[model samples]
Target: MDMRAPEQKYDPYRNYTRQQWSKLRDDMPMALNADEIAALRSMHDRLDLREVEEIYLPLSRLLSMYVGAHQRLYIAQRKFLHIEDRKMPYIIGVAGSVAVGKSTTARVLQALLARWSPKPKVDLVTTDGFLFPNAVLERNGIMQKKGFPESYDLPLLLQFLSDIKAGRTNVRAPVYSHLTYDIVPDRFVEIDQPDILIVEGVNVLQAGRLPRDGKAVPVVSDFFDFSVYIDADEPVLREWYVKRFLALRDTAFHDPRSYFNRYALLSDEEATATALAIWERTNLANLEDNILPTRPRATLILKKGADHVIENVALRRL
Candidate 1:
C-alpha cells in the first residue's frame, strides 16, 4: 500500500507518514515539557513530550508562520487604505469526533502559540459553550441529540465569532459544564481581542443552512483562517469512546453532581454495556450524520491510529 493516508487521483491533500512529517519540524526546538504536555492532554488521551516534539511542535511553527503572514497583511491593508484599522483575530477551527481529543489539541496549540515571538495572547474556546442548555434541548425535544449540530445555538455562536473577528472586546459566550452535562445558566466567558483564537468542537466545521434566495449566509467555518480535523476509523473511535466512558465511571461519574453519576454504581460489565448503548444510539449517529461529513472542509487532517497516536498527517494542498 502507498504511504499516503488515502489514495485519490483528484485528492486535494498532500499526505505524509509519521516519519516524513516529523522531518518537517526541522531544527525547531521543543516548546513543551512532559508535565505541561500532560496537563494539556485530555483525561483519557495519550500525549507525551515526544508526541509534542514530533507532532505538535512542527504544527505550532507552521501556525505561527500563518499568524505572522496575517499580521503583515493587516499592515499592508492599512497602508493601502491609508487608515489604521483594528487588527482582526486569526481564527482557527478544530473539528473532530467527540472522543478524538480535539480539546487536547486545542489547548496544546494555544499554549505553544502564546509562546511565539512578539508573544501573542491566544484564546481557546470550545463549541461546547454554544450548546443549548438542557432545559432548551428538553423543551425542543432534542436532548438526546446534544452533540448534534441542532443542539447548538448557531445564531449566538455566529454572532460571537462575528464580534471577535470585528475586534470587539469583552464579548461573552455561554458556559458549559461537562460534569453536569449541560449549559450553566447566567454563566459566560468574555473573549477579549487576541492574536489567535482556536475554536474547537465536534461541530465547529459544520456549515450553516442556506436560504434559497442566494443571500449571503455566513457559516461557522467562514470565520476560520485555518481549520484542522482529527480523523480515525469508526472502530478506533468507538473503542476510545468506550474506554473513556468506562474510565469516567471510575472518576468523573463518581461526582454526585455529574449527570452520569448513576453509571458509577454499575458493575464494570454493566458500565461497558451502557456505554456501548449510548455510543450506538447517540454518538455514533451524530458522527455519521453530522461530524464526519465536515472532515473535508478542514485545512489539515491529523489521522490517528488505534493507539491514539498520530500516525500520519494530510495537509490540504494550497
Candidate 2:
C-alpha cells in the first residue's frame, strides 16, 4: 500500500559528463601549445593540448565569469559605502592527493588565465612552503606525520592569507626546496597583489576541529573565492605515486643534493616496495583522514579516470 518512491538525497553539485562539460568551453581560445603544456606538466604527470582544450579551457572560462562578477560587486559595494579600497586579488585554492596531477591543473589554469584579454597578473603559490621545517618536526617528534595537518604552521599560514586578503603588498611566504626536502631558511617569496593567486597543495582544503567556545578559527579554504578539488580512485592514486617514485630514482634521486639521493641505490623491486610503504604510511593516511574529507567543501570537483584524464566535473549549485 506504500507507493512512495525511495527517499532522494540532496546533491549540491550539478554534475557533467565529459562531453557535457567540454561543451562549456564555449569558444575559449587555446592559449597553450603542446610544447608549452609539456613544460607546464610535472615530471610524472601527463597533460596535453587535448586535455587543456577539453577540460581546462572550460574551467578557465568559468573562472573568468566568476572573476568578472566579483570585480563588479566590489565596485558596487564601494559606491554604496562611499569609501574607496584597493581591489584584493581573487584567491583560488586547488587541493588533491599526491601524484593526482593537481600541480599540472594549477599551472595550466595560471597559463590560460594570464592570457585574458587585459592580461591580469596571476601568481601561483604552493602550501609546501608553509610546512614545518625538518628540525622542528624532529623536535616535535612528528616527523612521520609530516604531511598531516598537525605538521603545518597553521597560524603562520593563516597570517599570510590574512595579509593577502587585506590587499597587503609584498607579503612574504617561506620558500620550500624539494631538493633538500625542507623549508629553506631565511628565504621567502613575496606576493605583490596579483590580480589572482592560485594556491595549490595536497592539504589546502583541510579543516581542523572547531572550538566549542563559539570562537571563530578560519581554515585555509576561508581565503578562497573559488576552490577546486582534483580526485581519482585510491588505487589509481597509489599506482601513480609508486610509478613516480620509481621514475625519480633515475632523476632527482641521482642528484647528490637531493634528500632522496639514497633512493637511487634501490632496485626497481626495492623502490616499488619503498614507495608502497611510504604511500601506506604517509600519503595514503593523509589523503584518507584530512584531504578526502574536504572534497565536498570544494566549489568544483574534477574527477579523473584511471588514465588521469578528467572525465567529469561537478560544479556546486548556486
Task: Give me the candidate number with maximum TM-score.
Answer: 2
**Candidate 1 accuracy as lDDT:** 0.91
List candidate 1 segments past 4 Å from native.
1-8
Alpha carbon deviation, residue 223, candidate 2 (Å)? 0.5
Off by over 4 Å in 2: 1-7
Model 1 C-alpha lDDT per residue in residues 1-318, reported as the tens digit of each score = 566555444688989999988888887777778888889999889898888888988898788778889889889999999997689999999999989999999999999888887788899999999998899999999998999989999999999999999999999989999999988889999999998999999988888677999999888999999999999999999999999999999999999999999889999899989989999999999999999999999999999999889999999988
Top lDDT: which candidate number?
2
Per-residue error for 167 in candidate 1, Å, reads 0.4
RMSDs, each prediction? 3.0, 1.9
Worst 10 residues of 1 by lDDT: 1-10
Clashing residue pairs, backbone N/CA/C < 3 A, model 2: none
Q: What overall lDDT goes with each candidate model? A: 0.91, 0.93
Relative to the true structure, candidate 1 has a C-alpha RMSD (angstroms) of: 3.0
